[model samples]
Target: MSHTPATARHLLRRPDGDTTPRFSYGADYNPEQWPREVWDEDVRLMREAGVTVVSLGIFSWARLQLAEDVWDFGWLDEVMDLLHAGGIAVDLATATASPPPWLTTAHPEILPVTERGETLWPGARQHWRPTSPVFREYALRLVTTLAERYAEHPALAAWHVNNELGCHNLYDYSDDAARAFRLWLRSRYGTIDALNHAWGTAFWSQRYSGFEEILPPRLAASHPNPTQQLDFKRFSSDALKDHLRAERDLLRRITPDVPVTTNFMVMNEMRGMHYADWASEVDFVSNDHYVLPGPRSLDELSFSANLTGNIAGGRPWFLMEHSTSAVNWQPVNRPKRPGELARDSLLHVAHGADAVCFFQWRQSAAGAEKYHSAMVPHAGADSEVFRSVAGLGRVLRELEPAAGSGRAPARAAILFDWESWWAAEQDSHPSSRLNYKQEALDWYSAFLDLGVRADVVPLGTDLDRYDVVVAPVLHMVPQPLAKELTRWTENGGHLLTTYFSGIVDENDHAWLGGYPGPLRDLLGIRIEEFAPLLDGETAELDDGSTGTLWTDRITVTDTGTEVLASYRTGDRAGGPAVTRRAAGRGTATYVSTRLGPEGLCPLLARTLQAAGVPGDLPESVRGRVELTVRAGADAEFWFLVNRTDEPAELPGVTGEVLAGDAPERGEDGEAGPLVLPPRGVTVLRRAAARG
Candidate 1:
């Protein structure tokens, strides 16, 4: 599949060529779980809640097709007509999320196998293997049937390819996956000799003479080859992507007018699919994010939304699923606070989400996710959860002007690479606790804390767009990437990277000579050995901050290198803890220890100042408020989200109040400071600057 810019997709439904901008609102409507009588009520509440669209028939495979020869559309047809009559559009699903019981029973070979060789059975969702031929045949049949039947339906707004592909069965070691993996390897390496050389198979006598001799990185004694594991991860992600393409192609061929999308899991630790690689395959990107309980929950949410918007190329994307309150799958599902429901939804809007939707319209009464929060909770529409849902709908309707706007580009960015993320945290590394995603998130939080807007962009994004780029734990430094970074630095882009980076090439082979290999000259520093600290160990720096987890013994090789901060206590005391070297008009800085969000603030403040990056908020509201801007041709919409539980005040702010309250005016007719409510989000519209 070729890349399609998300901006080109006709995302929303417009009646009679109406060009009015409006945010799409609703949830995944699972009418199959409820009786026909309840669906009418569901649509009524949806209208009251200002819903313009709903995703239907996502998990209705068994209900839609009871048997191989049987087909049931009477219920679906009535539901579709009901939604269209109720003034709602439908993002109709292909009903291929899971296979029916009949198909799985008939084709047992479609089941996925674990690395230890245990077969995954049907009761759960996504039980089939991505590389299964029989599964694709049956899945494509359902897609084709649905596409042909609803090609011209009035309510059909978009085609949802499949629900969260590779969410559960991403890594399959079955025979089907073995064959697909071999084929993918052949395509990637082109020859068996090339594969052997890349995998470094000569070390373990694991060299293969032919592609057929290879297998999925299944359970092995001691440890599997690092490069083999990395390749398998890549292949598994591609396998799922190929399945997505199959359904997408079929749907487009049958219903070429409608756009197609599948929800991506871009939340915490769900790095199975490289979404940067998958974004171009869909018309518009959609994501399912569930907040993980912690102090960093809000920051992580903002980080993920920022990354998702950039993944969509700054064009508006979809918030396919989130929670109305508490989610069912957590260790202890806690409900949202008084203002969190509306605040959370608006934050996504601030980050360029044109549509806001939840998992299901009504909560399920008899399923694994029965306890999960929905638009209409188990307490019915009269409860607080439903009231909050309706209130959010009104906010979305009021902020309709923000629908198709693009995110205002930031002067700084944090590079997020899926391949580097996969390879950096693999087994047999310096520290088992080295988390790549968390490190990136920490940098994002620091930016937010300092009131600096920094886009969390993918690895291959244009580096020339930003004045400063931060690449944390960028482990895999291929030749081309190394050259690009060097060129970017020479072209006056400040490059700041952390330890454990630039150590390995594309094949996971250590860059010879010394540590931080490919970037040694660019950074003007060298390290002969890594000094990864033990758990609970800490190293004190002269800058009054402490580092943990990892440290490096630095040896400056260039006369231009300046030590920004040095270690005050611990191993290699008085050595450089942070260093910077001038290259062309810009500088390359390096941090040799793990300094978390709070600890990173000081360094970031100084670095950003040197790079001439501007902060968005005033000093008093720096950490208390988060700022995100969405700009159209004429105006910019500023989203001032209060990150703290206490109310925050922003002085000297002037804009048209779009959502949330406006600043109070004095008797003399002068507007006072804009006061943000506790855990609230405020959207302000300002005129765009003209050159």
Candidate 2:
């Protein structure tokens, strides 16, 4: 319900007497990894690359604190001073991301325990448990030390909390976690009877007489209670959030002028924390996104960036970290092409990122990530990566006028809910192949394939702003949410949802009458059973497309309902595959099968037309270029990205070229058609246009 208290632009560093907002460009600087002489060269190359800021001392806990009684700040103080002298600001970290060898050696009880009752050792980062009192005491002590030391430092711009909270240690089942889970359950349910009713514990003699008897869903003989697993996921996220609050409060108390933030890993499968709930806790939102290699890689990148922008409430956010080239973690690390470095960064900026940064500044010669690319790679400044970085810095400087702008909302949106994602993927589901995020992403990819601009927003966002909304795999629908959707549909808003939606309430209890219980009346369809398909099997539709993963046996129950597509082959032959029902001036559509992004294009085109949602680009150039817009007070900045490896053209586009590949000039010196190079991006400052 709450919004960001401040914006990243207000806290970032800028030139002297320059009222124009500047976009920040830099990478994480780890001076501790190199010799003292190399530090000077690092600063020189940083200025050459036009870096404005760098996140310092993220994984330096072991070096900063040698023992319980010993502390060192001599080297860090010098680095801070040197960066300030070089006209670069520092995002000072708490240096508590990982526990030192001495701390873990002395307090092994703070280690995390797995669901199989195995203790996690301290070789890797994030070995400490979120619920451990001993871990909190030590971490907070380190945080307080950093805040007090850098409270008045001129180079201090913002406070960086623990790096990527809950990235590796999200699910802990230790004794401390058990105690914390009990307390969390008590707060949520308030009574033992209430907890019992909510968890539906009477099925396998799993009912508990008191809150003390409740434990986290550990490994058992059979699958754990579904609600119990869901609640534990919630509690685990909350536990990490509580730690973030603790560190943030200390920083705020010490340096009230500086903003506090922690980087969220919002990329693929990093769903341990509910970022929509965590957004309001910090002063501003920051995210670390990495490109995943697949058929829909670019779509996934845009989807994550769009979701991050919405999570920040359309305000400018910081891109904390991304890869310059191939990441070291993937099984087969392939180096990035020539133009991908700048294209990726500019794409994030188009989605409302004011600051662009990467994982590290220089390539490491002796670490786990040695092969990972950086601004200055192993070949040094003469390399192509460094040249691209320098060129991007110049481009960012030219686009200063577009800074601090908000993302222009689109006419269509895809509703994303974390609770549904967590609840739908349990062990005892009807099918193990059901992936909630992939289904939602398929719709997004379809939108992009049609050249339609759609925002991927959270569930609670105002639905009235968009004419069409698609909610995919919304399995768990509480009663209030059901009513909310119904009201929106009745008010002349087009609604589209898929199979496995509205099957259960907040307590994960199935609706007794039929499937899709709450939305049955609105969708005008009744499903008595679900038909899950096996792997390598697919059902054919009358539209000449095949569907995989799932299908629903439907019976039309309303007079206004019309079957748009039907199943041609399967157990339920000649049945309705897709149906639409009229509700007031709007329509409610239901899809009972899984159609991938390519297959959904034909149907989605019709849906877009019915809802009066038009694509931003011309039909001829659709699917070849991706269009994103950001609105300033007086003008709009349009970003046209070439999605393929070939040259693309756009005719009759008028604007002032701000950066990237520029369009040709007409005979009379007017703006002409825009020609985008292969894997290129062009930004144009145009007159105030439609959002």
Candidate 3:
């Protein structure tokens, strides 16, 4: 196998230059799966593949701790010493993600309980309840042991707190959870009357006399109260966060110098946790991401990568787990096509990932994840998967120059809110299919198509940073934030919001007065009623582009609002489907329909141009490629990536190709249009004069 130069990875740099390399590469290592003889072979192979770090012992508590008091560390000590001898760093795990089977057998209540009142068995990992005191006692004991043993080990890099917190047990509905829920409500509402009012429990004679009467909203007689559901989601996230904080605090107390992080599963469907509130609690952010195996996989991957970087305050984050090929968890796990491995890894780097790692180093011989692809596939070191992994490792090392570069400045930003997603996805809504995430993705898809970079920002982030702010399906923009957004547009920041926006408050109650409550006056429009279409139905717009899934019948309350495009078909025909109104020195645009990419691209391009946001790309690479810029204090690195299978061309300027599938040179010192191979990625450094 081929390899890059041996080096550690980002993001701390001391004045003494005692820092590791800019990029680190490795995978999840579980030596407990193999015999002691295989451990030496594993390290040898890692060295050959340029592996610098491995996340160790994420689920090894059973092996480490035999009983309540009995403990064993001889094996883990050997593994750490072996990795250090092989010059590999260890991202040590607290081994709290999965508890041992005996613990569950002894204290069955420690396991998470389903909404149906069934305790989740211990066969699967992370079976413990996040809010249970017994689970906390055992998990923290394991973490304390690991921290004390490996705090000063030479191989230590970072502390992985617990594997993907709340992946399966996010909303435990046991009695413990009920008690915690009452406490959480007391803290939030301060009084039973306030809780009753917020939950709107007066409607069905379901009013609670006291905080203790409130349950987990489990197995409701009918559709659960929306506000209760939303709060439950918040409480679930906070519960896990509290556990993580406890584990993190213990890890830090033992090893204050080592950075600590827990991997988050960030995606459109996985919306249980509100990561915005949890971002500041970690030493650094790490994410576990996987493409959903579809046509829009690249776009979704880019969106997630950019979102991860943005959430980390534009700091270079760790790609803790992604696949080299097929992941076993998916129903129809599709293997990555040729050239996709390097392409996918490089895309994360373009979005400011300092390290690229996968779920595992080797495939399991037996277990649930036996079919899951790893850095070293079951086919051994000579396989195509290993070749790709080695190749990506090489390219990551080549990305040293742009390793610490932050996300380039963007003229546009999109609001990705957890509360809004939860509220929109609640049952008994106007439409159960109303996807808050897909709508946000629609706007991001337009940006990607325009070859422009946009920040996927949080709701509370400063609005003054971007010229254009797009909030698609912001179903619950509270009054204070709505006022802030209004001030932003009035101060010359172009604001864009979509259907179902400003309809609800933070409490999940509809904003009184009108359809789009707080934003109506600022947007210069009023939505009378929603006109959501059935699954197979679609409507046309004035520009001949089609909209599906949703549309709103809007009226121009203020004459200043300009109707850019109206619904050309349906009972609500001639209504303002899209409108733009002048707010101070800028525009407040609203698209009251799901216009997919076909209808959204041209509209966004026009809006961006109006906002003076540059979005020019080579015609050949316009739709089939991605352009991401990482601007450092000294330079700006422009990454041009080909997302299609066919060759793509991009008008090239004078710059050095920092890495991978470089542009071909043309005559007279004029670089020709960049003809990138299938799934090719190239980074170009702009001239200092341009900077």
Candidate 2: residue pairs that collide = none
Q: Which ten residues in a row are the worst by lDDT in model 1? A: 1-10
Q: Estimate each model's TM-score.
A: 0.98, 0.98, 0.96
Per-model RMSD to reference = 1.6, 2.0, 3.8
Encode model 3's per-residue lDDT on 60-160: one tens digit a residue. Answer: 99999999999989999999999989988888888888889889999999988888898899897889898999989888888888888887788887889
Give a tens-digit lDDT track for model 2, residues 1-691: 1222464345463334233566999998899999999988989999999999999999999989999989999999999999999989898889888999999999999999999999999888999999999999999999999888988888888889999999999999999999999999999999999999999999999889999898888899999999999999999999999999999988888877677899999889988799999998887789999898988888888999999999999988999999899899988998888789999999999999999999889999987888988999999999889999999999999988889888999999999999999988888889989999999999999999999999999989999998989999999999899988999988988999999999988888887799889999999999999998999889999998899999999999999999999999989789999999999888899999899988889988988998889888878789989999999899899998889999888887658889876766678996667889998999999998743
lDDT computed for candidate 1: 0.91
Candidate 1 lDDT tens digits, 13-60: 443545456689999999988877898998899998888899999999
| Residue 559, model 3, lDDT | 87
Q: Model 1 clash tally?
A: 0
Considering lDDT, which of the candidate structures 1 and 3 is the better prediction for this target?
1
